[model samples]
Target chain A: MTPDAEQTGGIIEVRGLKTQFGDFVVHDGLDLTVREGEILGVVGGSGTGKSVLMRAIIGLKRPSAGEVTVFGQNFYEAGGEARLAIERRWGVLFQGGALFSSLTVAQNVMAPIREHLNVEGDLARDIAALKISMVGLAAEAGAKLPSELSGGMRKRAGLARALALDPELVFLDEPTAGLDPIGAARFDDLIVNLKESLGLTVFMVTHDLDTLHAACDRVAVLAEKRVIACGPLDEVRRADHPWIQEYFAGPRGRAALAAKAS
Target chain B: MADSPAYFDIDLDNGVLKLNAGGDWRARFLKAIDSRLRDFADDSVGRDLIIDMSKVEYLDTAGAMVLQRTFHACEQRSAASKFVGANEAQRSLLEQVEHHLAPCFVAPSRPNAFVAMLDRLGAGVSEAYFVAIAILSFIGEILVAIPRVLTRPARVRWTSTFHHMEEAGVDAMPIVGLMSFLIGAVIAFMGAKILQLFNAEILTVQLVGISVLREFGVLLAAILIAGRSGSAFTAQIGSMKIREEIDALRVLGLDPIEVLVLPRVFALVIMLPVLAFMSSMLGIIGGLIVAWTAMDIPPALFVSQFEEAIAMSNFWVGLIKAPFFAFVIAVIGCFQGMEVEGSAESLGQRTTLSVVQSLFLVILIDAFFAMFFLEIDF
Candidate 1:
């Protein structure tokens, strides 16, 4: 499907967004749109401002100048209740599954529910348990603290927590950073499955080539403080950006090419 | 100019031995009189003996003992085997055993121990101050949390706070209880020893009661909590930062300060007074043991004396300090945790800083309270 063709409406639209930290211009005159029910993969090298772009989109860091409209609301200019209301519609899965060490897996998932929904006691517990199970964790894993969890399990728990409110949009940052190859593939599969089943739009920041190949609907290559190229996998690969050329020409890139060829 | 072997020079002037120069040595032994005597015939007594220990940097146990014996032998023979050109390390070794060779050999100018102590103390003071600043920043975070608490009531998840408090306060009880009990026992033991000398042993009950209620009990409890829960705060926040959980919270339209910080600060502020109360009572019970056994006081009289000495004012003073101290500890822990950069090393460093800062602030606040009470008539 074409990037914009399947969208009911734009879930997130950024126009002329500019963000700077003092003398450093992290993002300058950046414009993008994340359509409804599309996985938009943001790909870049370490300091190319991909994560910065995500931060700006999520309203964690305010833009220096420009407009970010989420669900037709002016996100950057919004205040108080308006901002929170916009935020509640989105979920985020961070890099390493930042589960609270002091909290059991169940309680970690329950945190957003209790905070946003004011659901409590047995009902909250049930919802937490259900979320844990949905992420492939056993019911008994719900009572276990973050410290007791394996690396893969913690990432799953993080995903479950992100999905707690059943948000329409999800932002994932390097979800497969330290995971083994198999684990990374499984997580990528989970992300794909979740998006397909839930009709959720995804904004993912990643360096993982596999995740880009396996999951992303459209890949946006960030370079020189803005999107250098953005489109389907084959189009982005054929682009002439030097970083993009080198990245997709590497060993992993060839493997992805071979997989697609087959 | 004659065919004589060169000797390392030995100079002893005004009870100070000075060695001007020496080359690095491989091995040189200072032979003792006993061993030398055992090796030599009596006819060799008239031969002049010199110890060439200038080449010896390290002395073994046997080598050192041999030197001692040789010195004694020289005294007996009315001639000294002078050790010349000994380096600083050799001189220190000689000085360590100076008692054995008093009046026979003069010591070199030793570096002032007081000066060394002062230098170390200076470094330690700077570290302590840095720790104090880290702690103050932590307290600043709690103050920061207060405004967030008031402003973001929707974000202050009370259930999470209660969950944390249950872990921090309730789970910590057994250890706190045991420590207080031991402290109480030690206090009673020490008081009994002093009171017995004055034959005022009956007053031991009042002494423990007042001390435990007013100062030691609360201070000890705060210190323990600082080490335990304060470190917990840092580790939790640090780990979250590492994992990007805090970022996740923000992404999910949650204020990390409101969701993570507010609840923790509130829970700590509320539970500290309760923990302090528990600690005070446990300490008194410890003191009660001493009163019953050592002082020959009945349990009834001990109870009455304790009741009379510890007023509501004393309890309030400690209780008031608890929330403040708890606030300080929690803030320090969370702030340091949040401030952590780099790897696991940063987390460990911040955790240590958190505990130390919390303890320092607790003591500082306690002193301020003491001064405040002293200034007032009450």
Candidate 2:
């Protein structure tokens, strides 16, 4: 698609992405589009390559064949500078809150800001503090290392770091995976709140159904080496795919819908 | 579809000042908008302000912040301010930022340099003291565990001991043999040169025999083992420490010292002597070969000279130190391994420290034995 035609185009466009590990195919001719200013939740079973899809989009894994476009620029075909320009517009929060164990929380948040912006030391530290507090953490949490923080706080710190550079888009992998129900709900609310306030387009890979209902604007289901369905929660829930039917009509799914209704 | 860069046009009609925002107002274009907004604010203060955002092709937090800051500044100056022409999404975001954006905090002040230095000094001393105590306690625990392990042979982890023995001793033999042989050859060459200047080149046989039996053989073997096996021990134990495997062992009502450390130490104690004796024989063979080739000394003459130059006590002197060197190397390696803290960086530092500490102590103990042997004329 031409740049002129993409005025209302997707912020992220993955077209015919094929990824394989040796003989095992993860994604074959998978296509996905994440529109501007929307929370897109990606779901799949245990080994359906949800994480693999995200990795390919984020350039952590090289696709055997595909094109990933960000901001209407083809990331896979772009040169180094062009790729970097596109990369600067997005940030990722990995599963397990991959915070730098060696640096304090504040320093971790400051890392991207210092790398991308010409902000001064004192100003960068201030920005880090603001981001930390924005994630609903105490100011004192900034001084502690990742190991010193609880699991939830570590995840919050990771989110703060992902938001450090004021990215237009953010990718989160299983943001609520290990948290308790209340903690997961709080995390979902934080994502929603941050998305609205920051005007961010989020591409999140998740297993939590409540996150889809509570936070996501749309849900994309990955199965059989492709995105089987992609749309709003209700629309995608009505997909005829067996896995999709088993997933949305399952006991856990019913419970999640009931919780959301309440 | 619009690919236009974001811009704003200001208009003042009567007492109301209206601003029309357009283009992509994201992070990439924030710098230009920031200055422009501030300039617009300075001129339009105390005037009722309206920002029309419907024309914006894109509006992210960077853009929202620019509008919100100007709005707040006008409100502070008693200028009635409100946003118009914003779509539902833009309106909601603007409202969210307006309500929830946290104020940036001031940076903390640095500590006084003098006080900071003193603090670091105090911390270093205390940390060192703590490590010393931990190592001492570990040694004591190993001593206590040894008898317990010996008494209940069934309680012994025979498999792990054999595995460690293979890793630390058997696997290390070729390198140890090769290294000792080279050292022996080098020593023979050096002795030959010095004694030849004095027309006493035959004495090279004595030098090679005595040193290989009493010093170079055991020293070379110990140093090699310390570098090789010591680092392996630290890395293995350190990773286990990081993964809470040690805690798991304790939870199962087992002593880590008895189960993990004693087997390793015992293996080293048994193998170090075997390795040292082998090294000594190889060193002697190497010296014999060098003597025969370089000095025109026949094999018979070299053998007779070597036998005459060294006593059984000379062999005892070298062999006696092997067990001590092994003990020091094994203990330090396991101690450092167990001392590893949470991170991979600590594991690497501990491994490096283990090799250095073991090598230093081994050489120091060798020096003491050297002095003791000299005093007794061994």
Candidate 3:
């Protein structure tokens, strides 16, 4: 298929998605649309399949039934070349920073670039170094292996790799998990900064209220196997769902709100 | 004005050159773009330039950088050039490139293959030296602590020692017995065949008795233990190290050597000799059966021939080697376990190294003991 020259609306469109494992259902008839160049925050209770939804859209997990489209192409029905073309345009940051354990941070960032591009080795390394710094990591951090860095640094390394291809869209799964509050806030800042600078349409799965309040342009809450509420934070905050009520009106939510207001 | 089949279409009217660049301007098309850029650069010399980029469906870093280079080239050629038709997102990305383009270091070239091989060889030698030093220090620590624990017998971890004995000795009986029995039978069969050539078939019992009691029984049992329990020791301790459980022990002011290593080594030392003696007994039984069936030598005559031909000193020589082999195997296994680094890959590597190193050292020590005992006429 040719590039979608007339495409100008949603970057990702998921409709009637149903995913199940044995007798357990993860998502039931879920629908979501991610507008181009906006950070969409996905929040859910534990085991509500936030990560599963991210995996499904990224083509890592095949949904039991769904019409998943990206950039006006049927993602689940596209041919291998078309799929690869779509895959090349998007990047994913897995939950555990999933940076390959053996490769240095620079090499990790270069992996996708090398896979998708025809750049020389020197050019690739230079691009990787730029990405590492763009994610707020030092140039020296590029030479170190994933195991040599702290948890926050590993997350940054993963971010650099996600941005390696200069992808139009990025999927981040709990990017701020396992970090201190200050570190998490710093990471939130980095995400917003990169999104504006790189024109990335970010689909982020997170449980951190502070991240949704601080960074995300829109908040989508997953409950009862589908998105119960989705809109601007102010609109989603007034959601009548019990989970949303307890989540945003709870002490942690109140603290996050106060922090955001400040 | 319309969709074009080509990646780049240029229309030049008079001294004004308009270049239309569109489609997926990503990394995969860099080679094609390189030629196109060269043509654009050559044709646009001294001509006013206008680049239409709005129709570009995608533009990544490679595309932006190449476009930036072309823009610079036009400036160098004294041609006034302007970029037009970039949408909000494309403009933002180009602005990002413009702002964040800082000088970066190129990755250093890798060493040649021969230099890499030499580098690995050097690293291997240093690794071996460090391992030898670590093992020696470990042995010295255990030796020093043994006297203190021996005097205060109540302080020894008796329960852990017995637990390990069950794991290493009692649990290993079936395989050890089977292995030794098969070896003994094979030796008898070979010996009987050769002896029959000289009409000395009865001598097969003596051959089986001497070899089983003096070497094969202890050697086979030690090698099996090295493959079995040695790997387990490394895996258990290496996982503990990975999980920082060893650090937890240290933080609690407890010596991991005393708690972990001592019990495992003590258990191996105590059980190996017993296992060896059992293997020797089973081996003799196997040889007795083979001699009776294969050579018409009854159990009665075989026992009498065995009693007359093999001395108790042969048994002592094999038994004496058991504890030392056990010590070496245990120490090497535990030392490799302690050397495990942060990754699961390190744990797996160290486990394999533990088994291989222990088996090699066991055989090497056996060879040394064999020569020493031969010199002394034992």
Q: Candidate 2 - CAPRI tier?
A: acceptable
Off by over 4 Å in 1: A1-9, A260-262, B1-378
When sorted by DockQ, best at the front, the candidate numbers are 3, 2, 1
Q: Give the TM-score comparing model 1 with the true structure, all chains together.
A: 0.44
Candidate 3 docking quality: incorrect, acceptable, medium or high: acceptable
**Residue range with the least summed lDDT across 10 consecutive positions in model 2 chain B:** B99-108
Candidate 2 residue-wise lDDT, B167-274, digit = tens: 889999999999888888888899999999999989988898889899889998899999999889899989999999999999999888887888889889989999
TM-score of model 3, chain A?
A: 0.95
**A172 in model 2: Cα distance from truth in Å?**
0.5
RMSD of each predicted structure: 29.4, 5.1, 5.4
- State the TM-score for model 2: 0.84
Scored against the true structure, residue B115 in model 3 reaches a CA lDDT of 98
Q: Can you tell me the DockQ of model 1?
A: 0.01
- What would the per-residue lDDT of candidate 2 be over residues A129-230, giving only the tens digit for each residue? 667877888877887888888888989999989987778899999999999998999999999989877778999999999999999998899988988888
Superposition error at B229 for model 3 (Å): 1.6
lDDT of 1 by residue, A93-165 (tens): 8777888767888889889877886666544554565557556777667777777778889989999899876
